[model samples]
Target: MEVVVVTLAYTLTGRDTEIVSQLRTVSDTLQTAPGLTHLRSYRGRQKGGAYALFLCTWDSENSWRKAQEQYSPHKLLQEAHKRQELLVIDPLQWVMHYVWGYTRPLAAPTLAAIHLMSAPPEQEVLLQNGWRRTLQHHVQEPALAYAFLAHSTTPTTDEAHEGPVTVLFCFFSWSSQMERDLFYSEKQIRTMHAFSEQGSSVQILALEPL
Candidate 1:
């Protein structure tokens, strides 16, 4: 079966406590939705709670779309929307192929990082290879939980935004936050830094399972 990760990055006009409560309601409602196997809710530490990422996994892209329509008019969702305005910065759907490690029977991770990256068209092949190799090395660690690497087949690009570029999504989960931070500060991440373009960067959003 194909695994798809749908990331909804949004900002709320209301307070964090209020927004999180609404998210919990959404999560509770999704329990009955078809095809949705996992739901992980996260707040972006990089922006001081101004942003949040909702990572959800489905059996396939088609099933996910069907669930969207089915759940669009749910009363729980309508109630959440009424409490606060959700300004979605990016609604990205990634069809991820397994590079290394096992990610099944999904559990709440202690900490997870969501990365959204853009690479020049010319470097697409190299970019994918670099990410795969780096991920493979990390998978060897017993503390590493799971890692997924995917690129957007249909990325949003316009004249105002940069022209059509390869969008890469990397999600990693660690046993603890300290290990996660160390992995980035040490040599492993530096190797990736040297392998890709200078402009290629990822936002390290600290995560929690809803």
Candidate 2:
């Protein structure tokens, strides 16, 4: 399975509540789309705005293309796009990230790490250290694919729930569920578990490409 993760960042021009409500509607529509596997909407905590994250899974890139073609004429998507303009300050550009299934490409692994933090303002150093250690040293699985960290700026708008201070986004690819299982159970993952205890809270999700 392969998937495309699309992320959009929007700056709200008015009240956070109104902006979030529209985002929820868009999410609802996306959830019903044929090729969409997962759709998550986030409101910026430090920077007052909205960030929309969606994962569209496919058997191949060709499958994704077919799905896109089908969605282009979708009335719900069109309506949502219009509503988005009211809430966003700038033009929306779709940012695309690719995920390759490990089963097909045995030589490559798909891995992703996302860290959400809500803690003491002074813990910035600790947070950075945790990210570096986990992404660089801990997840040593040779099949490891790609990794990245993302954070919002100041203003910190409340969309659905108040946003976290920072969010770390990482991606990795693997051949099979068994391999992922092994990697997660490894000592490095244990070390990551211990490191994460320092945060006020955290959320982890396992996702498959569409």
Candidate 3:
């Protein structure tokens, strides 16, 4: 089983660049830590807040704890936090630990979906009515850790690539290949069949954190 460490931080109004730089440094340090398999950081589009995701492949929680104790990155982040308080308005930090208790390491790299729909104006309403419900139900299954929605005001790297007004980021944690296989066969595939019937255009990607 693998574990996920998710951290969320909000920066002061004008400190976005500085905070992101510090977070990049922390991520670089995490790259060298034992038990750490993947690390990625995301900046909120509207408010310039940030989210850091870490995927750790550990023999056990004890193994993760040992690695954390020896990793200077943890302490460095603590120091950064102290400095951040002076610059951030009301910074928020949250850490969530999830374990895939079934059998296999969760999926490698991981999966991401970027939807480019034709009906830009009606997309959000359609998604809120149906897609959200389907995903919420899908995530409640034991194999999934958690899933939620985030609205970002940030622009895509290329305006040409932008079609939809919002993005949906979903996270899934699986215990074993069998669990994921069953989920696709029994749930996701069927849901896809239904979603396809509704003529929703979506783009999906599989991503790896580094």
Candidate 4:
């Protein structure tokens, strides 16, 4: 699957009307979009800093590109941007971060989390390999629906001017949020935490399907 992670940092705090309306419009169109297997929306909770994430998976990169040019949501979003009703801190930010297809097909009942990692260039491979190994145990868990990793092709804002930085994206899905929380709280997940600590920094986004 080709996953496109579109993150928008809004200027306002808490449910801004225009942003919510725009997102609702996009989510509605995404439900019936061709080639789109899944669409998860996330609203950031930071008090002073507010943002949202739209994680979308498609059959291929070509399909995604086609949607950008022809899809209704894309057209709506473009119009919103033009009117300054929907402002994103990084409008050009888009990442292709799913390297492999999902372990299970996308479904409405599943819940997922996205992890954004950055490490020194030299430690990139090590971080990727270690994290992959750490997730092996969870892959077979009955509650886990799917999981995959992706590396960023461009430098993230935080890494600009720093030494070569690699962005690592990983997504883990479970049948439900309750099941995911239960499984994630286990002591064994600490091992994955340790592996991630090897990187310079990491940010995790718990995603909800719209």
Candidate with maximal lDDT: 4
User: Against the true structure, what is each candidate's TM-score?
Assistant: 0.77, 0.44, 0.41, 0.72
Candidate 1: misplaced stretches above 4 Å?
Answer: 72-79, 86-108, 158-161, 197-201
**What is the per-residue lDDT of model 4 for residues 1-210, given as tens digits with 9 covering 90 to 100?**
465645434534544777677767767776677888877666554545655566666777778777766553445456666766565443434556555435655644457776777777667678777767666655565456766777775665464326667777777777877878776786667767777776658877666553
lDDT string, candidate 2, 1-210, tens digits: 454444434445556666567656655665666756545444443344444434333445555566665442233334665765533433322223332122232354333334444344345346656656665664444435434443322323223235434333344445566666765778766676566656545545444332
* Cα error of candidate 4 at position 1, Å: 8.1
Candidate numbers sorted by TM-score from highest down: 1, 4, 2, 3
Per-residue C-alpha lDDT of model 3 across residues 1-210, encoded as one tens digit per residue = 344443334345556567667767777777777877655544443434333333333444555567866553445566677865423433322222331122223534233222222223355356544655565556555443333333222222324335644333334434445655565576654675456336544533222232
Best-to-worst order by lDDT is: 4, 1, 2, 3
In model 3, the worst 10-residue window by lDDT is: 94-103
User: For residues 84-139, could you state the per-residue lDDT of candidate 1 as single tens digits?
Assistant: 76544434344444343456244445788766666665565577778788777665
List of clashing residue pairs for candidate 1: none
lDDT of each: 0.61, 0.46, 0.45, 0.64
Can you tell me which runs of candidate 2 are displaced by over 4 Å? 1-52, 55-78, 81-115, 139-143, 155-164
Clashes of each: 0, 21, 3, 0
RMSD of each: 3.8, 11.5, 12.6, 3.8
